[model samples]
Each structure stands twice: as C-alpha cells, then as structure tokens.
Target: MKGLVCKVCGYVALDGNKEICPICYAKNVFEEREDAYKMPDFKAPSGETEKKHIPDFTVVEKCGLIPGTGCVDVHVKIGEVLHPALSEHHIQEITFYIDNKFISNVMLTSSINPAAVIHLKGGTKGKVQVIETCNLHGKWFNEIEIK
Candidate 1:
C-alpha cells in the first residue's frame, strides 16, 4: 500500500502525510513508498515465508499487571515462527493502532526478542492493528478485534 515511511525507523503513515515520524522522531524524513507493507492472507493457509513475517496478536480482556483497572493487554509477537534477531537482520520496530488511530511504537535491537505488550485504557473497544518492520523483509501487518 502507498504510504509515507520514516527513513530512519521504518514507521509507515497510512494516510500518506506526517510532518514527523512518530517512532523515530525524525523531522521531514518521510518518503513515499509504493509498497510500504504486506498483509498476510489470513483466510488462506500460510506458507513458511508468510509465517516468518506476519505479526501475531494475543489479547487479554483484563489487564494482569495492574488488576482492577479494567484495562486490556494486547500482546504482539512478530511472526508465527519467531524471526531472527541478529545484528544483520532483526525486527526494527512494531507499531500499534486502535480503530485506525496510532497508539504506540516499540523499537527493538538485536538483543531483544520481537515482541511487545501494550496496555490499553479501561473500556477500550475497537479493532487492534499491528505492523512490524523487519530489516530484510520490509514490513508485515495483522489485526484483531476487541469487543
């Protein structure tokens, strides 16, 4: 899909316009990418190549870390088969969204695993979207509904 991508951190702006990159905090470094991301065919069986790039989500209705808050915990893991975390090729970052609105971005390095958990405010209800960028594989996307 066409979008504005951050040259430094690979964050994509689906609306095609952003003065600064939300992930990298880079100014005026956005470049238009004709194929910014690839959405896996969830309806069909995934191949080995697809399994290593798609983002996987695990949602908890109630928050575990902070109990009695009614908050939700959205866990995102990059790929069904864990992607490599070497210095040469690793997951650069993972961006979160709720109901088509940007939420947060988690930057990763070679030492850390390609996973993240975002705690949502109480009573949060909407479709949760996740995009993960791999240094060698470009970007991959996935989404889930929280009702």
Candidate 2:
C-alpha cells in the first residue's frame, strides 16, 4: 500500500487520501511513500536519478527460531539498489523494533555503507521493524514477521 508520508515527522498516512499529517499536523508537506521492497535502479533508463536509502530488514536465518537455542541474525540493507554513502547525502541511523518495542539503534555516517547485520534474541516471535533515516531524505521503514 502506498500513501503520503510526512516530511517532518516521517509519519505514513493511514491511506493515500489523507492530505494532512496526523502526527505533526503539518499541511502540504507530504510526499508519496516509496515502496522500499521494490528498489528502483540507481540510474533509471530514462536518465533520472533514483534514491536508494530505503531500509529493508531480511531474516537471514530461519525465522521460526527454536527457543533457548541462539540469537537470530537479521540482515538490514537497501532493498535492491545500493545506497551511496557519500559525505553530502547519506543515511544517519538505523533503528530496530520488535513487536513495537525498541531493540537497538545503529548510528552511521557517510563513510560507511548503510548496512548492518543485527542479532536479536530468539525467544520472542513477532514482527521486526527496521527504520532508517537519511540525512537528505526522511525516514523509511520496513518489517518482517519472525516466527
């Protein structure tokens, strides 16, 4: 589903129809929500530049983790296109949330690639949300269900 995202607060509209931001209450400050799952080419065939700061959380290991076994490693990276970690424009941070609870946050700069493999405890079976913020662009989020 696509909707307008608030530029100030990174709040995604409940539906694409909303013209006002629910969180920041800002008007006329919404941009179309880009689907991070489907990555656009770094340079489109039409000669347009595509942004690739969208975050995608992928379960590297099997999601149905056995309790008391070990930690589950989740690989966080750009969906398909690699994001340029340049000094002028780059991703600032990546935050992890499990079942709506904060888990970990990784601070990044332009020198390093905006990718990380984070390990989470294997006991809880729920949703894993990954939110990444770009210095130029706002925040982008994606999730995966872990069993």
Candidate 3:
C-alpha cells in the first residue's frame, strides 16, 4: 500500500494525497509511505504473526439495533487470534472505508477489546475496507464486498 501518512499522528491517506493530517490537524506534515498497511497474502497461508495483526470482518445485511433504518452492520475485530491489549502494546484504532473513501473510525484503549461495529447507510454496496493499527505491528487491513 502506497499512501500518505501523517508524521505526527500516523493517519494514513489511502489515496496517496492529503494536504493536512486529519488526526492531528497538521499541515504539510504528510509523508509518503511505501508500506502504509499490511495486507494478507492470499497465495500463502497466514502464520500466527499474520493472524495476530490482520483484521477480520463480519457483515450483517440488516441492522439489529436500529431496525427499519436500512443500515448495514459491519463488525470488525483486530485479529483472529485476538491481539493482546496491554498498556505498552495494543490496538490503537480501527478505521472504516468504503471503496477507498473515508467513513468512520473507532479509537480504543487497552482496557477494552479491540473490536468495533459500524453501521453503514442503506443499500451501501462496495468494497468495505477495515484498517486497524496496532502499537507494535503498525497497520493491517482487510476488505469484503457487500451487495
């Protein structure tokens, strides 16, 4: 993943361009990152390290909390093996994107589980991407198609 990252707050701009850092509100502090995120290699089997860093998704077509709202529930977990949540090393945040466009983000602490659920608009269909940043592992992302 080639993108622009905020030098101050590590906010990634997947489009490879950003004038200001969205997280830190810093201008002219964005730098190009050749490996902004880590994606699972489909051709190779994932090891324990990959399982601990890669994000997982579970999509529900209907919103259980708000029925009749026509919202799609997207559940995101940090990893299949469940990464450790310690004061030193933990999942810092999880970001949502639809077709490479920004949607929402969830900031986390070590006290809680590294997971989040975002509700999308009705009839939203595209490549739903989830990116999670670990304090030790940097960043990892996974995508799923919804129709």
Candidate 4:
C-alpha cells in the first residue's frame, strides 16, 4: 500500500495501518500518498522551525455560511517559508479536492508565486484537501474540515 503523510506536520508513515501521525497527532489529516517517497525524508519541526518545509495553507477569504451561492476563495502558500519557484526546482501543480473528489487544479509556472489562489464553488461542505507536487521535493497535502 502507498504510504500516508500528515498534511499539517510533514510527518511520513513508512508502516501499515496508518491511522494518525505520531508527530502532529492529527487524525483526519493523514492521506494516502503514492508519490510521498520522492519527498525529502524529515521529521516534524519545533516552534522555530515550523516554516521550514511544510506547506502552510491559509484561508485568505471564504464563502458565506448560507451554503451554495458564490465562490469560495482559498489561498495556499507552498510552505510557511515559501518554497522556491525556479525553473530548475519548482512546484508543478496545486490541486483542490472537495469530499475526496477533484474540484479544480492550477498548473504553476516558475514565473508566478508558489502560492495559489483557487476558487471553489460554494456548495461543498465536508472535507477540503489541497495537494501540491514539487519537482524536487515530490508531493505534499493539506486538508481542511468544512462543516
């Protein structure tokens, strides 16, 4: 089976029955990632190193609570420190998933910022996952519980 990774802490699971990440202690944040091995092997960082390599996604703006109307704007920063977006090494794509289903994807370029602003329809209300792949670092994932 593919390995699992913690979207919050960048913790990787090399074993089976991966339910929760030991480092971050996040349950629903773990997702089965097939390309996780290509990512650099590392442990969760402490307070000062939080922005070292982990992607930090923040909801810059969101839709109203009325449910199903306008669009939801989500901004994803590649990492707390912001990953490099160069021609040699850069993020390839940022994908958005709603309720484990594909919603939209943005193909990134080295010229633009590694961060992405994705617009999702205002109907989904379950789990929102943002997955990105780096040319040199492989794949990373972040999830948000929408209720």
**Residues 64-115, model 2: lDDT tens digits:** 4555666788899853477778999887777677775556778789888888
Top candidate, metric lDDT: 3
Write the residue-wise lDDT of candidate 4 on 1-147 in tens digits.
Answer: 156667886545544435765555678787877756433235643343234334566663345644556566677877777788789988777767666555666778899888777666665466777667677766666667655
| Candidate 3 accuracy as TM-score | 0.92
Q: If ranked by TM-score, best first, what sequence of candidates would result? A: 3, 1, 4, 2
TM-score quality measure for candidate 2: 0.60
Clashes by residue pair, model 4: none
- Which 10-residue window of candidate 3 scores lowest in summed lDDT? 14-23
How do all models score by TM-score?
0.87, 0.60, 0.92, 0.61
Off by over 4 Å in 4: 1-43, 46-53, 60-70
Give candidate 1 regions above 4 Å deviation: 15-17, 26-29
Error of 1 at 74 (Å): 0.6
Which candidate number has the best TM-score?
3
lDDT score for residue 78 of model 1: 79
Q: Rank by lDDT, highest first.
A: 3, 1, 2, 4
**Model 2, residue 77: displacement in angstroms?**
0.6
What's the residue-level lDDT of 83 in candidate 1? 88
Model 3 error, position 106 (Å)? 0.9
